[model samples]
Target chain A: MFAGGGKTVFYPKKCPRVRPAPCEFPIIGVPTGEPLCTIPSGYRPNRKCTYMDYAIETNHLSKNYGQVCAVDSVDLHVQPGEIYGFLGLNGAGKTTTIRALLGMIRPSSGSVQVLGQPVGPNGRGPWRRIGHMVESPAAYPELTVLENLEIARRLQGVTDKNATLRVIEQLGIAAYRNRKAGTLSTGNFHRLGLARALLHQPELLILDEPASGLDPAGVVEIRELITRLAREQGLTVFMSSHILTEVDRIATRIGVIHKGRLIEELEADKLIEIRARRLEIKTRDLAAAQCVLSEAGYAVSANEDKLSTGDQRAIDAPEEVATLLVNAGTPPTRLAVEQENLEDYFLRLTGETI
Target chain B: MNTFIASFWAESLKVRRSLITLATAGGFMLLPIVGGLFMIILKDPENAKNLGLISTKAQLVGGVADWPSHFGILKTGMAIAGFILFSIITSWVFGREFADHTVKELLALPTPRTVIVASKFVIIGLWVLLLSILIFAAGLIAGWLVDIPGWSSALLWSSFGSYMLIVGLTYMLMPVAALIASIGRGYLLPLGWTFLAMALAQILGVLGWGEWFPWTVPGLLSELTGPSVEALGIHSYMVVFLTFVVGLSATIIWWRSADQSR
Candidate 1:
């Protein structure tokens, strides 16, 4: 059934701020003729369509170009008000999955539903609520920054004229508002792209490398902006990035895909918890330190100039290793424990060295 | 209706801001100005030669200096040069989205992709029609400035009809340009197709089979190659209409179903 026109089915547990419809069920968990909450304003939710909890849900979604599998049997469930970071190496099917999610590309096999509506055979989806920036941010270079955002705002069916101005200030492209987009710096161009995505105040923001061309400060600003939106406005963000640090900073949950398969999916805290930790002890007497640590029953190895251990005991008690080294007359120059960062963890998971 | 309005507004702003709009307008106006200069030369050939305005080596303007001659020049220019200009406009209208990599932005909006495509076609039609009117008006001004004789309401109305018919035929052929722009995903391929079609139109027109070729239909209707009635038959229009439907459907289908991997 087409969205926005059908018999009401099921009850509404938490009604979105839709047009109030008189209901015999007392507006409790029943789908009404009114628009669904979390759907962008222009959309008309099919009342007969049952409610779905997840903002984005996919089942066994696979996309193959010829014999090469671009995405292989991926199932994803992203809840509302969550920031799900999609991580992958270059050519790792992150983009393919994103395109599928946006209905920009068809799935070779399987299904995708966004905001409870099936995605495209002809660019059909819950697009009103979904603002996406796929791959590089492409704008009509001949147009000014403001004009570009205005276009986005109108096409996204945003009736508010100030929406474009708000996003321009938010993305800090106000200075370039009147300048042709082709002439903007890469960072500003990226800002303009982001501004366009944010113009409609969407419930879901699907960004691919959203910070690709930004400077360090610009990257932090974007990170903060995304974090604020998801926190304050209850927005859902499904962003794909190869920049591990960027994902680590903002992503609440991380899904790592490699060679067209999702290798791991975990909460950010859980990812940190599972990352390898090592104790490194440096001394003037490296040989003496190694022997002392080895004799102390720590699984010690040499990494370049320092003696390191993957032993949990050594990691848990760096003081113990330090005391042993000092008591052996090889006073430690440095002693510290280091946990794997997202980059190291990503590289390790992808079977690559730092 | 709302989506169409929004899409149309967006499409209009892009065209209004582009340098191509001004460039095409300037290029289109040259037809009338040149044709008027030819009328002046033909009006007084001896005086033009003495004044170095028309050298002895200058080519003849063919038709006598009158309203019909002026209208004929305008009509023929609309058919020949208008095709290229119209193709360029069509290419930019559809091709710029891909050239600028903005097609993705348009694809997943609340507005349907088909609506967006239709809006572009509407804007393209309006833009070309506006240019046709501008050129025709410029032709009138040029004729008045040249002070050509033999003007009458009947001749004027008939000329207007012929001019419009020629332009309508040219406009019908633009969908092929839109299709090439879409499938090629940029301006170059469509522009290349335009040049190829123009070359083929000349070849086929010379070979006495121009009536069947969609690209040559406007040239035939212009009555520059032969009598309009003989140059075009009922089947000629059918072929043009078929090309329009096929090109338009192909563009929409490509937008609807093709993988937008780019």
Candidate 2:
């Protein structure tokens, strides 16, 4: 029984009833009973208001396949015109989440709203305004690139006959327009897939592994295309990928899901700030350099035969570290201040290597 | 209406470009061609035996090389071969999306999944119907070329009616193949179901319960069991129609509701 004077309270102690508070926020994992003095920080009093403000929103969205939990309670909010990068390892539920968002899969619990419309009960949604490419790009293999995009255009109800040619040119697959899709290379196949998704000129794009098979130049081209779409047309993009560096370059915001849980979500600038910065010094006498740094009250660790320290003092004044190491008869061979890259940060957060 | 038209156009394009379309058309033509070959063999058993077309102990399957016997062969061929060929078309129409990994493209579209599924069924139906007509025309030509007797407008009309009825009944059973292909997500399972159904129909027809089995009803109507076999009642057509409804509804429901994780 959750009873309070106008404002519902969750007790940290005693039997805290896990029910919807007066604010309509369900008390997740909170114990039942006694009126608590303060509400938990997880509670969102204006969740409905927040939902309308987002282009794509999911509250406590979960999906399970028999015994395996594919996605847990994932609350995600993607703002309009933002390139929200969803990073996860293989089988970490990135595709599952994309499928649920696209209304291709029914979530076992919770709900998904895309463009202010609920996604299901009959796979109904604002699909006309939303374009999605799930998992691998697929097309009618027997159909030519133009024909495939033409089919996509017709199904999307785009009356402009030129829409197919425009997307073909946009995705740089114009050269292969007349070629059967089955004859395309892997990268071109991916481009065709992206072309179909962009053929509709949708306001929101949800793509899974958009750059899975592209060459380096193709990857850059797709990244620039997506970035331009968001900048000029105000397209909202929610893309899931294992390519962390790619996501790092263009993503306005980042979400890291590990093992079906969104472990980290932050702005791009915030990610840059939180990434570990360290002063790395490579010396012939590693033990002496370590000892000198340790004696100077700097936390030191050996990484790949390099004496590494995260001390602000050492980073700010590398000359002082050099002077100390030179005096200690162990002149540094290599010394540089290094900030963690996205790959390093992702590995550190997920504890898994790319 | 526009969405349905658009989806239908899309489905038609896919079917037109697929090699399976030509393959099924060619495969269905074999029914009439083979029936013609049987009429040729039955027309001159001793001469064919001397020419090595027939073995010494081989007996002709169809009794005579007349127009009536030719029509009978065509009807029987349509019942059995039509089942297999139509099943192939249905399986390919529904299963190729999954096989080619294009089902996801159709899932989240302005065109509803129901419309897409219905369009695919219509395409399959139209394709098999055209093949049926082609086979009938070819059968008529084959009967004429063999110079068989019993060529009359009345018999032709009646035989065409019976032949179309067999084709209709065989086509009605194809939705089950489409349903299986969707649920199974490939050609192998539906083709496997087709074979299993064929085997079961043969077994049940031999047991004199062909009228009760939907798969056997077409063969029974074609008189594959025997002309003297009791005529099927209204319940037989009702059962086939019921199967058509169930399969169509189930396929549509699966497309609308099943989690298309692929």
Candidate 3:
């Protein structure tokens, strides 16, 4: 179904993968297993690639168990091939919502369409194009890595043997190919899990806690893999993470769920934008600036030498800050606007006071 | 069929590549061979009171026509093989998928939940069939190595069919056990429940109570006897079929409903 008014029908033929990252940022270290290109070079940022955007769509989908509303009438739309991050404290219904979308649990209200098909109305046929890791590394400890991939390949009707190997190597678990999965460490086991999901070369992938108990390196490994799934492979990813840092880095769009309710939703960039603008303007004479701005009807607060105001709606902030400082008898020497990041922005949106 | 076929191929490859299936099969064969040798050396032919001794004597010698008891060591040997190897196969039939996390991959492959689970049933069923063949091969080897002159080809085939039926029915427990395991997230829950059911059925059989517990009916309807025995008939067959239906139905239902990750 073509979405009217600038909604292009998503298809493999019509859309190609849009590279998200041009170079690996030094902010986080990545594992040596696979080099996931979070931002590939030569990507046109304005291109339309829904397969790389909102590959998963849920419309007013809800699930209720007696009185518990696991997921309440939520509308989730993810861009094609973007790593959509989901966050909430435990029992916020992240897992429940995920399970519902994957057809694990039947929803009590509304509809869920994955890859543009009803998740429950039909059976698992549409799932062929999707690969999901629900809780842990969905792996068999007894089976070797190759054996696991064999099972995954057959299920996906994946014909090319070489392509499967490519995913395995890309996930960087090729060294553990012959070892029993049970013997691998939790981190390596997760790598194998990633390999299994990618073995099918699915258009959409879902991961729940892809880096739960990992050491620093393991976390890096999973994060990079998630980034690659979206940016390099051109696969849409719906991932749930407790660590906001990871979410902040990988997510193109984000949904904050609390007590089974999606309290907020926005583009990740917007969150950064809003956060980067919150500032505390401290002058030598804070009381005078507060009086001057208070008389001028500006959002200026006074505590000691600081007059904090994160308002960007003012016509001229420098002139007002100068005038307030000059009138307060406190010279405007430290009149600066500090940048707030994603974390601060989120806290503010969620009504969290710091 | 395409999904079923793919799942089958995938499940089969997994079992074949794993050492558990091979190791379990080898272990079952060794138990009879190693245990039977010691029994033959220690047991006294003069003491007819000792059933174990009589079975051992029957195992060592080639004189089945002049056997000392109604049955022989073969029943015990076959039983051991059935329980051990059959359990191993059954355990993997369902448990391995969850254990290996292949279930997630399989469930996401777009096959119907029933078909996904049914493919496992089919794979385990075929594995049980392969195990049955292996059991017959082992029995034939035992027969060749130890003399059972009166053990006719008809008796061997009859015994084979009975044992095959027993092993096959035992596989019904696989899906049920798997469902329980998946639900419980541990191996002990399914095996413990299955074993308890088996023990209870044996107690009921001794008491001659409530028809037959689902557990014993498979053993009774299946091939658990000396070479020469009559068919279990339509009544026994119906009971066994019902057991299979229930086991498979439970697995499919649980599989479709249970947390896909678990």
Give each model a TM-score.
0.88, 0.89, 0.77
When sorted by TM-score, best at the front, the candidate numbers are 2, 1, 3
Q: What's model 2's lDDT at B46?
A: 74
Better of 1 and 3 by TM-score: 1
Error of 1 at B232 (Å): 1.6
Worst 10 residues of 3 chain B by lDDT: B62-71
Q: List, residue by residue over A1-354, the lDDT tens digit for candidate 2.
A: 133343332221222333333445433221223232344667544323322346788999999999999999999988766799999999999999999999888999999988767998366988888888898899888999999998998899999999898988888889999999999998899889988988888878999999987889879988999998887666789999988888989899999898899999999778878999999999999998999889988899997789888999998999999999999899999999999877888899999864
For model 2, name the residue pairs that clash.
A15-A32, A15-A33, A16-A31, A16-A32, A16-A33, A17-A32, A17-A33
The residue pairs in collision within model 1 are: A4-A45, A4-A46, A10-A30, A11-A29, A11-A30, A12-A29, A12-A30, A13-A29
Q: Write the per-residue lDDT of candidate 1 for residues B1-262, one digit (tens) a residue.
A: 3999999999999999899999999999999998898788778877667756353323343447788888888988998889999999999999988988889898888898889889999999999899999999999999999999989999989989989888888888888899899989999999999999989988888788889998888888776553354868899999999998888898889889889888
Q: What is the C-alpha lDDT of each candidate?
A: 0.83, 0.84, 0.64
Candidate 3 residue A176 C-alpha distance from true site, Å: 4.6
Docking class of 3: acceptable
TM-score of chain A of each: 0.84, 0.82, 0.76
Per-residue accuracy of model 2 over B124-217 as CA lDDT, tens digit each: 8899899899999998888888888888999999999999999888888988999999999989999999999999998888887888899999
* C-alpha lDDT (0 to 100) for residue A347 of candidate 3: 66
Candidate 2 residue spans exceeding 4 A from truth:
A1-51, A316-319, A331-333, B51-60, B226-231
lDDT (Cα, tens digit) per residue for candidate 1, span A1-354: 012233323222333433334422222121112333343445454455356557788899999999999999998987666699999999999999999999989899999988778998597887888888898898888888988888888888888889888899888878889999999888888888888888887778999999887889889988998998887666789999999888988998899999888889898778878999998888887887888878878888887888888999888888888888889999889998988877888899999775
Worst 10-residue lDDT window for candidate 2 chain A reads A8-17
